[model samples]
Target: MKSNNTAKSFDYTGLKRVISLGLSQSKGLFIGVIFIAVFSACFSVYRPYLTGDVIDNYILNKDLVGLKLEIFKLIILLIFEGILAFFTVYLANVVAQRVIKELRVRLYNHLIKFKLGYFDRTPNGVLVTRSVSDVETIAEVFNDGILVLLGDALKIIFIVAMMYYMNWVLATIVIVILPLMMIITRYFQKALKDVYQEERTLVSKLNTFIQERLTGMNIIQVFNRQQAEYSKFSSINNDLKKNYLKTVLYFSLLFPVVDIVSALATGSLIWFGGLRTAAAGDVTVGNLIAFTQFITMLTAPMRAIAERFNSIQRGLVGADRVFDILDANETLPNNGKKKLEKVKGKIDFENVEFSYVPNNKVLKGISFSSQPGETIAIVGATGAGKSTIINLLSRFYDIDSGSIKIDGIDIYDMDLVNLRHHVAVVLQDVFLFNTTIFDNIILGDKSITLEQVQEAAKVIGIHDFISSLPNGYYSEVSERGSTLSVGQRQLISFLRAYIYNPEILVLDEATSSIDSNSEELIQLATTKLTEGRTSIVIAHRLATIQNADQIIVMDNGMIVEKGTHESLLAKNGYYANLYEVQFSKMNS
Candidate 1:
């Protein structure tokens, strides 16, 4: 069953926020929709009056011509009301589409600006749910929920007015049952609201759980943990199912109660009308018929209000969740006025210090420089902050206390877009979009031509493989490049990084996942690619970096040694000890 458990919480503040922000985006359309609603309501109430008038003044008097005229009036009014209804639906939808568009864009803009730390700490599945499903839920509110409720309320007001004007006694009788229905609605609403909020939270958890499991399916299967995973998934799925069933149960109980009230209301109208007709007979037959119709209309709105209220409440919950994302203040502050059109690769890290968590520094007073056209390799034990250095230099995360500069200017003062443009990163685990190979290589940068990409791929030795594909460069890839071999995907990463032609290239274990045959191919391409550009390599294979101009070895978040490979080996220090241990294990 489809779930209605995605409401975060019951907060009118979110609805108010949406109205405040959404109005400015499509105010004119909203105003037009309201006007159409008002016109339709006013025009519809006239028909009941006309129905009674046709009977009392024409049919009762046996004036056939007059009755025909009254009938014509009703037909004309119906046409006018139909046109107004069309306008209401069309205008409201346009306004809803506009609001949804602007709202999604705003949320996405905020997501892109958020600090990397937020992403590191937050689950990918939660973010994806916020961006995709939650945003879509908000759109339903605009399209069908609140706007429909507003129109319904107006129609009910007009209906009540007509009923009272026709006969106050009958109006009073119908109005009595409404209070009872409303009380029941309120009670059910409270129960459902909490359930809705819990359901939404569970959806995110389930998404995160499924996403992680699918991502690590290989590990799970290798470890033979399928039964364990199945049990865990069953528990979560059952929880979601229970929440939905509760919602179903509440609704099931609600509508039947509404139907019972509706039946009682109709029964009372007939009994009262007949009693008066049999006695003093102040109420005419025409009035009796009209009162019955008016009572039915009034009860319809009473029944409908409950459903509309639920829709509105659900919308409010969605709005609350979306607002939470928009209100985040954890975005990286990149407000530099400096803009560099071009940079000559010269990177310096002075007294750099950082921590993913406070009171635990990852890089401790580190200092280093990469001169232009130099290949600098970083070797370190795990947790030595080798990857942390690459992350800081790329401005993916800021340092705690230090100055990182490019071309003699602090990167903190440079435009974030421009600063990142000069840096390229190729990770050991490559990620590929589900798109054509050409599109993947170009990465939406229209300035780079196809010829340029193919040429770069050729130079990097991936062109032949791409050409062998059914669609060549235009071949469609799957999510994360699952369709391609590990070596093939890694090679594509090199091509993608190379095509950008960044001044500073950082390869963080880029060749670690490749087999020996593929490793040899990358070894040949690495030299040609790193030439005439400053490069930073992080690798477990010492052979790849033996010819590097400089080698920095780190231990426990501190750089303990730096020199040429032979020089470091000559020192027989920590680097030499690590190399011997690793190579000896390989030989064994």
Candidate 2:
């Protein structure tokens, strides 16, 4: 969650992690890129040196045969260098692409295992940015940042060696400018890195804002706040523009200064090298010409050094964000070794206590039990801990002090996957993927065939509805099934749960928001669903649970009344008052 973009020192540890991820699956490609780069550097520097060789040894002697042979050798050298350059870029890109793919996979795999609470606190856009754009930035580190910098450095070293070998005095003149160039380059690198970090942070915030605003655009329109939202977006857009301009300004300034310094070095090389040639016949014209070429070659890498550092810092910033999620370790513990092949669906909550936050209990010493093949109805007003019971039963959140058991075995001792497999929950708001109705129902479970889906839909009394669609079972559902009516979507949810054939069924306000006709259909489906399974129904509507074997009335996280519908009404207590009030409202 924290970004280290503006840190004064380089993050060598993060760089190591990025390198490790790149090399994890593509070590051969990475090694090949490095090897190609080394050979390419040698060819690049040697070409300039060879030109000097041609000028001094062959061309100066007026030997046509020697000049032609040297020209042929120069041509061959250029060809080999071109080939090496091509492979260097190609292999580095391959390594980068492979690393990015591996990084995305690792990030996604880590995110899927994180507990619900982690998601509750994190923005959807932040995670999306990290997984996508931020991970993509890391590719530059391999292709254009680290490897390119390495090759350029190697080339500079070879050019310096050649200069020193040909004429030490001229080499010293060129070398004196380097220390100053490095000092300036280092300063710009640090400055650019800090600004880039701030820029990246702003980008994340901007993405988060855009994602949230788009998701809630309907609310903005309904509330007549379009202009207000637009203004907010404009402000963020302006800030991003300013940040980008700052980057451009720094780059514009840095490159010109580098060019100016390179020009100074070239001037000094010509002035000093010319003097020695004119005075004592010490320095050759070929050596002076070659030194100029070496200076030009050295300037390229020198200028690129700061730019490459910027790229590396950008990648490091991205790597930090990605590794933040990868190292979160917020996943649920699946230490339980017990896997039940078949669960009998006996559920019990004994003296349960739970709180999403400390000292703010959502469930207070709650005790409940449902025998196999019995439907237990839980009734409560908003925030009375009704849905919390279902969540606890599903082990979505661990209890602070209690034991939740299925078939008299503690749920903690049961494999999380197996426990969820045997338990099915149908929420009031059903979520369907933007996919075919059949695919949504099967959910990639290869065992659930089209035939099985149709049969399940038929059993749930929704087959006729699906058959009426243009594409029948293959009809596409929009995002969150917005294209489907609430009733129709509910039916799809019912069919999905039914096909699973879970041992325990949880219907959490399943029919509370639908029309009477849809409710009636769902009522029939519910009856079929809870037939022989231990079922838990959380409802705000009293009439829906009148036939429930036992009705538990909850108030402020405690059960105040519990009995059959008749028994609770006869007692004329909390349940009776709730039932009377709901019926009066309906009749009114």
Candidate 3:
């Protein structure tokens, strides 16, 4: 879980995987788009030659009736072309949107299965960018880019063929310029692709910075460091600006090179074709005119090819990043098929060795157990692995060694979904969604009714407090329940766990930050929440867990002492020392 802010190299394997996945799922739509594009290319190639025919057959001959007829036909073709262009844009987006929907869902499913430690190192903003901004960039590859590119490429091919059929010598003049244009374009592609990746990385960094600063705005304002924070943001903003400018710089240079090459091709067509027409009386004036237009058509697609090629490269960069997440080896395994209809909640951990990072063990061979309907409290200093126990039992992270069991059955052999469902937790830092209080309590468990929520709230003695709100259980809580007090959030969490009706309940320092009044209410609620359930409480106050059937004191990842609170106080060891310190603070 160690954080590494290193740059990624180009991953073509990932690029291919992304392309295959997107194309395979959108095969019919892609074929339809290509067919439309080819039709557009045919019209493009035929139009210039049609214009040449009009010049030679009507205007030069002065046959006004025939000219009128040809002009009317051309108008009809132009209208049809417009309609084709419209569908080309529309259908490309339809395909892109469908592919993006599937990819985004796949990314979410893969990301959620990642081990908790993976998130410890991965920033929230970076992931947000992955699922949102980067995915959009990938969509642009098809929507704004690839469909147009296909039309342009076919147009170029058809134009070249028409020119050669009219006059090969004139076609040769156009062909000679292409190699140089492609070379310049290749350089632009490499240059733009590199900068695009750097640009995306900078964007992710900026997002991370913004997300962190906004979340910690209270801290920044209290310390009056707004100016300092502004300066840091400016620095990041400048880096993004510079990265963007590098892409712009490459584009700025590329367009001028393309323009110069285009002028040279057009000039050669007019000069050489004029001379040959004058000397040999073979090449027609109409051929010269058509050749210039043909060169224009061809060079436009070349420019497009370069531009769209750059866009595709940018999409590939995004695809590489997304694939990296999907390809990670850190997902939690769900190979076990055993399901529990009703858990008896007898839990055991034997010689459990665990670590967030390699060789930096956080839980060292800890052994403990709780029988059904029994209550156990884990007492420990910060980083002594108290919370780590809950994490392992719920399979949030797999233990490095040894076993955890519930009701004499190994938890690793139990269905992960069922195991998590029955082992409910009210975290110290409760997170409430910005929604109605009733929704937060029910949390999408359709089996639980609103009445059940009220019943549980009453059991926890918060029914009156809830009903006092303007909308009762329907009252909206602000983001992360900032509108509610810490204790109130804790109470809602208790109600959430209770409504779920899990067989094992974990209260990890649930009352640590609450006011005395809230603590008393929670103490009354705890009895009802823990009744008939195996309960594990981790608390610093010590008073909340004094009646715990067993208390285990840990230090530096090892269980240093274990017994009931009174029995441990009699032993006068680590638990006794911690209890005495808290008791003295309360007395003072």
lDDT of each: 0.82, 0.87, 0.86
Those runs of model 2 whose alpha carbons end farther than 4 Å from true positions after fitting are 4-6
The digit string of per-residue lDDT tens for model 1 on 332-379 reads 878777988777788898999999999999999999888898899999
User: Which residue pairs in candidate 2 have backbone atoms (N, alpha carbon, C) closer than 3 angstroms, thus clashing?
Assistant: none
The alpha-carbon RMSD values of the candidates against the true structure, listed in the order shown, are 2.9, 1.5, 2.3
1 versus 2: better TM-score goes to: 2
TM-score of each: 0.94, 0.97, 0.96
Question: Considering every candidate listed, which one attains the maximal lDDT?
Answer: 2
Model 3 bad stretches (over 4 Å): 1-16
Could you give the candidate ranking by lDDT, starting with the highest?
A: 2, 3, 1
Q: What is the overall TM-score of model 1 with all chains considered together? A: 0.94
The superposed Cα distance between candidate 2 and the true structure at residue 127, in angstroms, equals: 1.0
lDDT of 1: 0.82
